[model samples]
Target: MINWLQHAPVYPIVVPLIAGAAMLLLADKHRILRASISVLAALAQLAAAITLLALAAGAGDIWPKGVGVYLLGDWAAPFGIVLAVDRLSAVMLTLTAVLGVASLFYSLARWDRLGVHFHSLFQFLLMGLNGAFLTGDLFNLFVFFEILLAASYGLILHGSGVARVSAGLQYIAVNLVASFLLLISIALIYGVTGTLNLADLAVRAGTLGGTDRLLFEIGAAVLGVAFLVKAGAWPMNFWLVRGYSSASAPVAAIFSIMTKVGIYALLRIGSLLLPTGAPAAFSLEWMFVIGMATLIFGAIGLLATQQLDQLVSYCVIVSAGTLLTALGMPGVRLTGPALFYLVSSVLTTGAFFMLVELVERTQTFGANVLAVTLDLFDLDDPESPNRSDDVVGVAIPAAMAFLGLAFVSCALLVTGLPPLSGFVAKFSLLSAAVAEANASMQPADAWILVAGVLVAGLAGIIAFGRAGMRIFWGNDERTTPRLRVLEAGPVSILLLLCVALAAGAGPVSAYLDAAARSLDDPSLYIDAVLSASPTRAIGGH
Candidate 1:
């Protein structure tokens, strides 16, 4: 049992799964109890992640295949599902835990007001996220994705306002189509490869020739489409803005992590499931183009929107687009920066979403009083100084100013602005793209990276400008006060996280670089999987 505990990476997956269920059952009617358990569970997961990362970082040879593949109930690998915690999955699981804890903290005060089942749904959502990142089998990845989508369905529409419900339906509809296609893609891959274990599939894929290659590549493309859709890339991201705009702040904050999950899956499978001599050099380029397009589209949409939440939602789309564009660059080269940008974007965007909620509540005033005082600012009045009375509020002015700072920071990060980590990440990708071009002596790839950066930057500026104006300047009418400490505390903490990421980019960069290197060497992962004796079974890292 001790040997199994040491070899098995199952704790990462099991911790969340068990915590989620226990949170639901044990919370009872006391909101404080639920919040305490939820926060503790999330921290426990984070602690475990820190330990796992420390262990991996310390050892030269941590993973061994047989031991890493912990079969549930002591079943063998081929018949039973396995959880693979390669470097990529490990980083992502830790990310989920961090973001999950933040979101739960953000929701503590609002949980009771949100509805009876809000806490449960949120935990379940985390469960799905952790599981998806850790699963070794393709089929189980699909299952985890579905679980996430299902939990999001409830969380997204938790308040169930007319607009929220309508948008949630559209969001679910689009994903349903993509989900079906994803399952079909998996079935095709399983039929062709005769196995679903990612490591085994990677080894076996090399033996295929002719028709088999065609079938696999096509299957890969189909699966790629599903991930692209989830990532909110161009041509399929129309629903992202609407859904995010409608959901409550905490829901939207957590939902931002979902697109990153899609990006992670694409990278994980692209590295592990494809043959080394995989067909088509342009697929990555295609991903880059889609990201560029998303950046432009999101910017345009943000420029047109006046609402605080909607603007933030579109900005998220722009960030996701840029991240995906970076991923589409060729080679094992962009791995470090891509992961860096992804982590930064997730943290920054989550903070911005929370801030938007706070601003919206504080900026708007009571409708009843405003209606009574309408005559004072009536434009038709002969003696009126209406223009002078149009200020939004003191809190809003201060919040908007900070929000603008946040957006500029986001722009700097996303556009690879100088001295910021975003620039560091973009620099890495551009350099790789340039190297790939020089090796092939083709100027087109370099041109693609340049053009993509320009378009994404433009979009970031336009979107932030539009959103900033509405959040700071716009005042159509007044509404009831909704200020709550739980809400502000989370936003403040998230903003601190963003600041920490930017300020400590060097150490952060090293950790991500190490992660990328580990990802490139999958033998370590295989060893981890196979290290355990048969007596102990595992499911995920």
Candidate 2:
């Protein structure tokens, strides 16, 4: 048992890989069986992820130094692919699993049957995510990234509509370019450092000072830009709103985590190679600028959007901008809160994406067009009552009531308002910013971030108000929407998670702080990966 337990780092990747392969072989006709297997696999992945998270945080005594590196085929690092797990990777794995469970179960209602091999594609996507999180080798990071991208290609285009196809093609083209850029940067780094292992790169990062450093910095800049593009930063996010909004609800839900994956890569690589007090690889100031641009653009887009799904996509952009803005700060002080915000925003956005589909069912297409026309002409909705109806109105149906409440919950989350995790997250971020400002932070930088956060929150309020009025209040002549248990259940679970996060903010913040502390001390990670035992060294050394 101890021997097998030592290999826990690989389980997150292996479980989904095997599951996907099995589903591929089962023939697309057996959807129920495939869904059953997918759920089982998702549950198992969640279990493994939680266990890994616990182990990384030193909950148990079995190799609980907070970092574990598994050398593939019992070969040591800098030679072959290595799977490493620490607090950050473990948390990411856990988040992906939770999102996967929600997305897959929701798909069981209809999205999976819309296309062939959906279960397989879904499982493969999870496999790719797990692999990307666990890989300790740079080259293999690219490998796992491609794996995930390939799966996402199928997922984004699952419904096969004209919009979905166009958006999917754009998504595919952008990522392929990013992947090529990643390869170029990797090659440049390898040429200079002669190593591809992340730990090894960190070790060598400080030693370069001359032309090598220049080349490396260039490489790092290219790498950062590629990921920022993937992160849906401004200019790069032109396709994001359309792509995400066009995708099926489940696909869009799972895709909420995809941009985070790109941001995660940047965080991981940056923290490793440029730890606190280390030489800077990419300028935090430029990163902040990128974030600010994205945040402002997304806010404007939010106000301009009439569609709920499009608004949700802009919310995603704002969330990314928030994360990037926070990450632009030096030190681990604000990173903890950034991580917290990531979890809160992702859960809410995923729920909102799925909820858009449900809410749209109640309103008619003509009503939406009319609402747009009213806005263009600056005219009031004729059916809208001019005064308050103190008496009584048409009784709200259960489905509409559910949809309205869910929409409000999502709005509260996106707007960083009270009674949800989003409020807590934003407050934490602001508190951290103030604390940082008290200690040598530039006034301009601090205020910019502060203003960005506030304005973004305000944008959420305006956007949600506009969308809500159009969907719920503006059109009273609509039919009652149908709500399937599976469809409704996933969104409920996701939002409930937000509530739970708010309730458990204390412990969750503590965990995230520990994660930040570990990151602040990258030497711990480097030491573990280097000291890990291997049955045979490279070339049988």
- TM-scores for the candidates: 0.83, 0.92
What's the distance in Å from true for residue 310, model 1?
Answer: 2.3
lDDT of each: 0.68, 0.85
For lDDT, the strongest prediction is 2
Tens digit of lDDT per residue, candidate 2, span 1-541? 2566677899988888998899888964475788899999999999999999998888767656799888888877777678999989999999999999999988776567666788888988998889988999888888988999999999998865477799889989989998999999899989988998999899887888889888888887788877888899988888799889988899999999999988888888888877522334355777778889898999999889888889999999999998988998888889999999999999999999999877876778734642443344333534443211211123334988899899999999999999999999999999898888888547677678889999989988988998888778888777686567878899999999999999999999999999999888888888989887785543333
| Candidate 1 stretches greater than 4 Å from native | 1-8, 26-28, 59-69, 279-282, 365-440, 473-485, 522-541
What's the lDDT for residue 208 in model 1? 80
lDDT for position 221 in model 2:
76
498: Cα error in model 1, Å: 2.3
Candidate 1, run of 10 with poorest lDDT: 386-395
